[model samples]
Target: MRIVITGGLGFIGLALCRRLLEAGHAVRLVDSLSPQIHGALPDVLAPEGAEVLRADVRRLGDHPEALADCDAVYHLAAETGTAQSMYRIEEYTDVNATGTAALLQALARAPRRPRKVVLASSRSVYGEGAYAAEGTGTIVQPGTRSKAQLEAGQWEPRGPRGEMLRPVPTPETLPFAPSSVYAATKAAQELLLLSAAEALGIEPVVFRFQNVYGEGQSLMNPYTGIISIFFNRARQGLEIPLYEDGLESRDFVHVADIVDALVAALQADVPPGLPMNLGSGEPTSVRMLANELLAASGFKASVRVSGQYRVGDIRHCYADLGRARDVLGYKPRVSLAQGLARFCAWAAQQPAYQDRLDAAAEELRRKGLGT
Candidate 1:
């Protein structure tokens, strides 16, 4: 297939570009090159015969010619993370929302259409994920904990009679409770692309990615990926910080597994225009992951459970993966220990941590985005 991937130079995008090229597909990548995401540009995003464009997808309507004759379009460009997006509202809206709008507009005006269109949606849109009341046991989307609750250091949502709600794997059917601006933008991006592509008689697929991590990720970025942040901190012998009593859990899926889900969606007979959760379906707590990274990194550092918690951060949320399995025949092959080992090896090749996490947290504090 001939393909064009927006944000093609990004960590995920570049990985996709390489996979597609290996499969003998002609690929073209479109990227805007935001410095916040890419600390430094690599030698090339696309492998030896593929094309790369240092262009913004927000201007895609003006450059519709580049997408001509492509068999599919993978939209992966966006500002990532919840806490960072809470303060940088305009950047998230412009890059993630408006950029997607331009791509859809270009497709609408173009003379030809592609066979498929896939979007990089996120699990963050589900907020606290599907939860069940302890007594009644009815599944529901528990809303974010109140400021008063957060102030009292109560992390979990409460049912009537003060019963604790237990978080379950968030399925695609869970109503969106996007807690941060970034999550809202991603949720909006999925709706816009799916609706627009369906209107144009094209099949659209949305993959709500979990915490995707592995090789080639930006270790400098502090606002996302707890695994990378912990790894970077360990390399410097800095203390590994955990928030909210260190029990908050998330689903971490390797980048290779994420690529498998995308490839399956592209080729499989998945029902069109439905979002699927892409994750390893295993929940790992912050404290456990921190300990694992510390052990794997061969570094000595105390794990501190900071009472501080970021506003809009969830207590626990992992992917159900049922839909992904049935729809795309997807199953994560990388175990957490294996993935951590791979990451630890990758960390040795990267530069030492610069302690940007403090600055990142301060940026949020300056805007009251953190509690």
Candidate 2:
């Protein structure tokens, strides 16, 4: 198969490139090399046979000929920061929403369209609407603050009383309550892809990804993976900061598993308009993640509880994965502990990881937090 991967040099994109190349598939990589998340391409993607182009997906219509021959496209390029989106809302909309629309239009005009287009959606689209039930078996809203916040805190509902809130793992059917511009753009792209598929005969597959973490991740990027940030801080014996008492949970999916599910989706003979969750289906709290990393890295570190929560943070957001397993034949093979160990081992050998971590710490220190 011939595959064109947009944002092919990114953390997940590069990993996908390596996997496709190893599978003996012809690979073409298109990336804009945006200053924000650009990193060196992996050795596997540096081969002479691979096609590499410096093109933005937003301008994909200008080069319809470039995507003319590919069998499928894994659209992974986007403005991927949630916190930064609060400030740079327009930029997020332009790149993620408008850029995706431009690519869909290009595909529509292409002489030989790709058979399938897999979009990388996000669990963040659920936003503050995702939560878990408490010991009282009552569902709690994600945004409520409490006075006695433990290291592993819990959620409390904020709305009207006597309303029964059900606690079910968030499926793709859940209504999107995107709190950040980044998430909003993702939700918008998902809708656009589905609508385009229905209206224009394009085959679109949407994977709403959970928290993805693994090798080649930027430890210095404040907006990148939390596990990467914690690993970097723990290696230096710095205080590991926990947001909202460290109990807020997320389903951390490995990059390898993500690629596996994507490949499965691409190979399936299913029709367009299929949306599924790509996740481990297990929730891990920030405190538990920090402990696991400490155990994995042999780092003795003190955790600092900031007791400060982000405005639109989700308390518990994990996928059911039933649809993914049945439709895409996907199952996450790497456990959180195993993934953390592997990542730490790889990170300890890289000077770039340490440098990025130090720079991030200095920036945070200047802001008088997360030292």
Candidate 3:
């Protein structure tokens, strides 16, 4: 199959491209290589028959021809950050929501439309709704606050069930109650893509992804991935900061597994308008992750608890990936321990991580914390 992947040089996108190439498929890459997450585009993506187009998804008008000759598209480009989205709502909408619409419009006009359109949606759409009675196996309305609220002076408002609210490993049927602007735009984009599929005879598949992390990640970018941040800090003997007691849990899916799910979605016999969750169905707390990282890196460091929580930060959210398994044969194969080992091994070899232990120690001392 001839495939086109937007944001093909990104962490997940690049991994997907490599997998497709190894499976003997011709691939075309379309990416703006935005400064925020830019990395070296490997030579495999530039082999004789491959094509690479430099264009932003938000400005698809400039590269209408990039989608030509492709049998399918994996849309993975977006402005992604939950906390930042609260302040940059318009930016999120423009890139995630409007950029997706623009891509659909371009596909709609294609002389030979692609057979499949796979989107990288998010679990954030379930938002506070995941805490509602309907979502938590209890009956609660949309706006009802959880009884176990965050303590006074906490940064964000607490939900019902207070900090004890546990997300029910959300399925596709969950309602959309986006807490952040980024999530709202992502939810809207999913709807728009499906609607366009119905109206334009396109086949669309949406995958709500959990937190993804792996190699080739940007350690310098503060908002990219928590795993990367922790590894970078630990390698330098810096204290790892935890938000809200470090007990908040998240489902962290490895990038390799995410790529596997994406490829499975493309090759499966799934129908349009189908949305599934891509995750491991395992939730790990922030503190546990820190311990895992420390053990993997063989580094000693302090953990600083900020006791601060971001607005719209959920206590816990994981996926009920049964649909993905039954429909797409998707299963996460990488264990968190193994993934962390691989990541830490690679990180320890980086020149940037050497000789920074003192600076890291100094920063931790100033904060009055250590592991």
Q: Tell me the whole-model lDDT of each prediction, alpha carbons only.
A: 0.85, 0.76, 0.76
- 41-160 in candidate 3: lDDT tens per residue? 432244445578888897776677878878899999888867667666688899899999989988877777888899999988887434434344562214322323444433233345
What TM-score does candidate 3 get on C-alpha atoms? Answer: 0.86
Q: What is the lDDT of residue 143 in candidate 3?
A: 38
Q: State residue 350's C-alpha deviation in candidate 3, in Å.
A: 3.6
lDDT of 2 by residue, 1-371 (tens): 99998888778888888888888999888888776565454332444466888788999987775586988999999988775675667988999999999888898888787888899999888775444454355544443333333223444444344343444577776777786678889999998898888666668888999999988776666666888788777777788888776876789988999999887877786556667888888888889998998999898889877775544455667888988888878889999988988898988886544435445445544543323
Q: Please give, for residues 217-246, the per-residue lDDT of candidate 1 as tens digits.
A: 877788887888888787788888788899
Candidate 2 at residue 230, lDDT?
86
Worst 10 residues of 1 by lDDT: 37-46
lDDT score, candidate 1, position 98: 92
What shift in Å separates residue 302 of candidate 1 from its native position after superposition?
1.7
Error of 2 at 272 (Å): 3.2
Model 2 / residue 230 / CA error / Å: 1.2
By lDDT rank, best first, the candidates go 1, 2, 3
Per-residue lDDT, model 1, residue 81, is 75
